[model samples]
Each structure stands twice: as structure tokens, then as C-alpha cells.
Target: MPDIEIRQLKKDDVAAFKAIRLEALEMEPAAYASSVEEWVSLSDDEWASRLHMPVFVAFKSGEPVGVMGLLRQKASKMKHRSTLIMVYLRDSARGQGLAESLIDAVARFAAESGVLQIELNVSSENGRAIRFYERNGFRAIGLIPAGMIQDGAEVDEVIMARRLT
Candidate 1:
């Protein structure tokens, strides 16, 4: 594989971000809570607002390949925690250790930001992802039954977390 570059997304990256994000939602409908239909109609400003958080994008030789976001809790009491969301990689980029790099980048940022923990939700049916998270030190903290409705069916979601401090 070529050198993969991961960096914080800027406001001007709205178009690239939208393209990759839409592809993710469309290609892997079961892995995400939001559907393509829901995200497709979002205005430019709405998409740009997503970058206000600590969202990072991965590029393989100048082409966008993956994206992830870290959202810090705004409430004072929960400020030590952040949720990892919107994690996705293009089909061509999987199984190349890129995901681990992304997770490490986020964890490093979390530690620098004084966050004590990071949380994420993953579909129970995605065994590969569950194992990947576990390998990266994130353990299942809880399970939400019927947490997401996909194609008229209820799917369970596992809540996973890792302590950064």
C-alpha cells in the first residue's frame, strides 16, 4: 500500500468529506445509524458543521479513503469523556492496519485533550469490527437492544469504551 496520510479535516474539506461520508453510508448501510437517504439531503452548512468537532480523514496518495470523528461531551460533569463516531473506510482500504492507525491517532488526541475515556457504538452483527475494537483496547461496556432500525429490522448495538488516562 502507498503511504496513507491522516489529518484533521478543515472547513474547506466539506466536499471531500461529503463524498466519502455518503459512500460509507451507502456502501455499508448496516454499519451505521444514519441512512444515505437521511444524509443525502443535508445542506452544505449542515455538512460543514460536522467538521466543528475533531473529525479526521485519511487519504491514500491524495484520495480520501476514510473518516472518523471524536465528539467531546459539552457538559462539565462529562467533559472527561468523548465519543468516537462516524468511523468508516473505503472498501479498498480495509485489512491494511489503517484502522488501527486511525484509532491510535484519536486516542493520542484524546489523551492530549485531557479526555479520560472514549466511547463508541458498534453493531453487534459486525463481528469483524467488534474484534478490531477489542484488539485496540476498547471493551464492550454495554449492549443496547434494538438500538437501531435498519431496513425495518431492529439491530442490537454494543457500546464500547477505552480509558485514555
Candidate 2:
């Protein structure tokens, strides 16, 4: 694989972001809470607004191949925590260290921003993803029964967290 560059996505990246995001939703509908239909009709301004949070995209040869975002808690008492969300990598980008690198970038960013912990929720059936998060220092903290509904089926979600401080 060629060198992978990970960087913070800016407002100018709306087009690429929209393309990659839609692809993710299309390719793995069960993996995400949001549907392609929900985002496909969004205007440019609405898409750009989503990037107001810290979203990072991974690129190879200048083409986006992966994306992730860190959402900080807005409440005064919860500001020390952040949630890692919208994590997805192209099929071709898997099995490499790219995901780890993307996660490390988020952890570093969170620590720098005074966040003491980071959390994420993954489908319980996604063993691969659960293992990946565990390897990266996230521990299973709890489980939400029937946390999500996909294709008329109830799916359990495992909540994981890593202490940064």
C-alpha cells in the first residue's frame, strides 16, 4: 500500500465527504445508524455544517479512503468526554494499520482538547470491530439491549470507552 495521509477535513471537503459517506452507508447499511437516504438530499450547507466537528479523512494518493469523527460533549459537566463516531474505511483500506492510525489521531486530538476519555458504540455482532477497538485500548463498558433496529431486526450495541488521562 502507498503512504496513507490522515488530515482534518475542512469545509472545502464537503464533496469528497459526501461521496465517501454515501458509499459507506450503501456498502454497509447495517453498520451505521444513518441511512443513505437521510444524507443524500442534504444541501451543501448542511453537509458543510457536519464538518464543524473534528472530522478526519484518510487519503491515499490524494483520494479519500476512510473517515472518522470526534464529537465532544457540549454540556459543561460532560465536556471531559467525547464520542468517536462515523468510523468507516473503504473495503480496500481494511486490514492495514490505517484504522489504528485514524483512532490514534482522534485520541491525540481528544487529549489535546482536555478530554479525559473517549467512547464509542459498536454493534455487538461486529466482532471484527469489537476486537479492533479492544486492541486499540478501548474496553467494553456496557451493552445496550436492542439498541438499534436494522432491517426490522433488533441489534444490540456494545459501548466501549478508553481513558485518555
Per-prediction TM-score, please?
Answer: 0.96, 0.97
Cα RMSD for candidates in order: 1.1, 1.0
TM-score of candidate 1 against the unseen true structure: 0.96
lDDT of 2 by residue, 1-165 (tens): 577799889999998899888888888888898999999999999999999999988888888889899999999999999999988999898988998989998899889999999999999999999999999999999999998999899999999999997
lDDT of 1: 0.91
lDDT for position 28 in model 2: 83
Off by over 4 Å in 2: none
Q: Write the per-residue lDDT of candidate 1 for residues 46-82, one digit (tens) a residue.
A: 9999899988888898888998899999999999999
